[model samples]
Target: MESMLFASIKPMLATVGDEPFDDEDFLFEPKWDGARMLLHKQGERIEAYTRSGRRVTDKFPELKEAALAIIAEQAVLDCEGVCMNGGRAVFDDFAYRLRLGDSRRIAAAARSHPASWIAFDVLATTREHLREPLHDRKRIVNECIEPSERLSPCAFLMGRGKALYDWTKEHRLEGIVAKRRYSGYQAGVVSADWIKVKHPVEIDAIILGYRMLPVFAFVIGLHFRTVRFKPVGLVEAGISAEQRAAFLGIVAGGLHAKQEGTTQWLKPALCCRIEYRDRSDWHELSGTTFKGFLPDKRVDDCMWTY
Candidate 1:
């Protein structure tokens, strides 16, 4: 069997928005909290790539095998490679498995924290389906892919987005994504045709310092427009080592002060999105987790919310 000619394409991105009303023109799907991957299969050969076009075929052998199991002559699928634990997608476990370079460790991780591909769109079959409407592409994906333990179609709810969002919140799922039924796939673009509404309390915070001990942690501060910055809390979750290194590099040379037994303070020029529960009366964030660095956001944009 020959391998498919793979093309590096950025998957379509979703815009953040409030949950929308249930409308017949849209379909809603659960937003899996995992790495975005594109799967390509031809005959008995299969390959996978990250949303950034990084080739990760060998990183997930089980998913590759699952892709090969797909019933198709040639195909390209937009999927999320999720590591589910107790019926919930765990991003940290999925990221850890994706970073394992050793075969033995990878095998062990696969046995312990196996990943699955939740296919959301069919970009191509024997022919390209890029210009097809979302509803048509969704139908094609449902018909072409053979379901297995490691692979399954992403289920969608039609004109019931509010109910789905309520269910997602009640079940502690990541969020709900709504896509316009008539919108065509547009690679590498953050389009309004699709919107994502998360179930967490999200806020923008300013970077203050970081700790390198026991484990890596980022100390962030809260700001209210022109108000002074105040230490809110520290977050040691949801960020990968690679992301930590990248963040350190971004804050390099911006150091302002350092406490011998505490943190290395920065200039507070960087902003990041944090997901957490309500802030305590003492102004400390509860159940905080690093979401991602917000490059487009500025320090002045960070606002404190109680």
Candidate 2:
């Protein structure tokens, strides 16, 4: 039979309350700091698929080798390939490998910073497509992928709304994702079956100030409000001449540094998005920036949390 193709999408749930897992409701898993992929193995052949459904077996030879080495006769998996160094995920390091397309860099990356698989779902383990309820799929995944250094099961905190929320915050995990225990797997976008909660809301703020460095142009700050134009935090800006030029291009007539009252300030016109770890003390930022600016969003609508 031709290899089956599984949808690369899965529902990501939001946190409700910090509720504890009761025996009947839901299962939880660890959120991996890695790229998501679909793993397929049949006989001696193995392959990986990107989120866009592109075949990426050749791009991750190490992972392909792991799949082939599995003693299972045939299987399909939903997993993430995280490149870890000293127990921390290094997205930049993996990105560098992506930029270097040749086999040499691929081999070098494998040796210097290898990728580990975090198996979360089992699409197929026996000959049938387990399009059954998500709860069952998770159970089979746990049974199939044993805990090893290279392969570990994702742990989740399943419970009532408030308890799970508390656990998520206490653990400093991304946030608790609440899922309806009976939902079936749906291919495409995020399903209503799941929900997520992140602390320290993210927001879009205006660029208000910056600190210039010899290595870069400026560490940009953002404004929390336009009418009041309150200074929030700074984003590491102007990393390169080209970056400085780009930033200048984005902001009208570049930048001019001066002081406003007792505060050192830059023009509050440029906008940026930033994510924070918490919002308990949103009112004050004694000696810090608004958090970190996210380049993927607009300045006018910087994400914010209450």
Candidate 3:
């Protein structure tokens, strides 16, 4: 029983062009549209856990039902917990589901907006630990189960780097992840086995003030400052906790007057490389983080234009 517990680890990401390996040499998996879930079953009792170590079994009744119906013996599999509404992912549709504590609501939502387990990697089966080679474990999971209305394997494509990148863009998918064909699973943080090839999206923007979230510490903003930082956009995707701390320390007391409406203005001392999908004439825009500045990228580089 102890040997069957192979922990699944998160993948590490590489910058757009840093240490890029040949795509043909790596396995490419689709970036799923869901939350990371770990499934562990022992006898008649089954448990579903979130990546953050929280038990979410009650929140997803459909998954619970499917787990009981299909799984055999003791096994651990890494998958994405996806909620399907009208045959497509609504992205943030599961927000209410997580917070919902009522079992009746859970059942109703399970029937209305069902959840699917998109299996990506299998860590263990019975007493055998398949973590040593990803290719072997993937084959075990791929051949063991048949696709159903609620379960499917993650999509994969094999090609050169440029071809895969082009395919991601054509499908409007997030990006392709590159993983070594043979690498063991290592738990906690990002592991060395994986590298991501994502569309390079960047923009030069001035840092406005910061809005502090309770748990997230601080969130930065980007909008034209001449009329004051009137809530044009936010930065959430790329900036790390270390960068957030450093940025907050740099602009600690540079808050200007609340402009245009109720938004606050911050001193323009930072310029960051932001990635987004929308590129339009300025009035308002939506984007997330991609990468950030080097210590050498000076504040003089940030200037806004209409």
Worst 10 residues of 1 by lDDT: 277-286
Candidate 3, after superposition: displacement of residue 203 in Å?
11
On TM-score, the candidate that comes out on top is 1
lDDT of 1 at 112: 93
Worst 10 residues of 2 by lDDT: 280-289
Model 1 C-alpha lDDT per residue in residues 1-306, reported as the tens digit of each score: 123258778999988775456889999999887889988888787888888898888777796669655887778999999988878887767877778999898888888989899999988888878798999999999887888889889999998999998888777677889999999999899999999877767888988888888878888888753457888898898999889988878777555566657677877778888987534334677678999999889787687642
Q: For every model shown, what is its TM-score relative to the native structure?
A: 0.69, 0.59, 0.63
Give, for candidate 3, the lowest lDDT window spanning 10 residues. Answer: 11-20
Q: Model 2, range 201-300, lDDT digits (tens) per residue? A: 4556666655444333233334333335545444442244565566666654655667544434565556654444423223332222244334665555
Model 3 lDDT tens row, 174-215: 456677777766655475567765554465655664555432
Q: Which residue segments of model 2 deviate by more than 4 Å?
A: 1-24, 160-173, 199-306
lDDT of model number 3:
0.59
Name the TM-score of candidate 3: 0.63
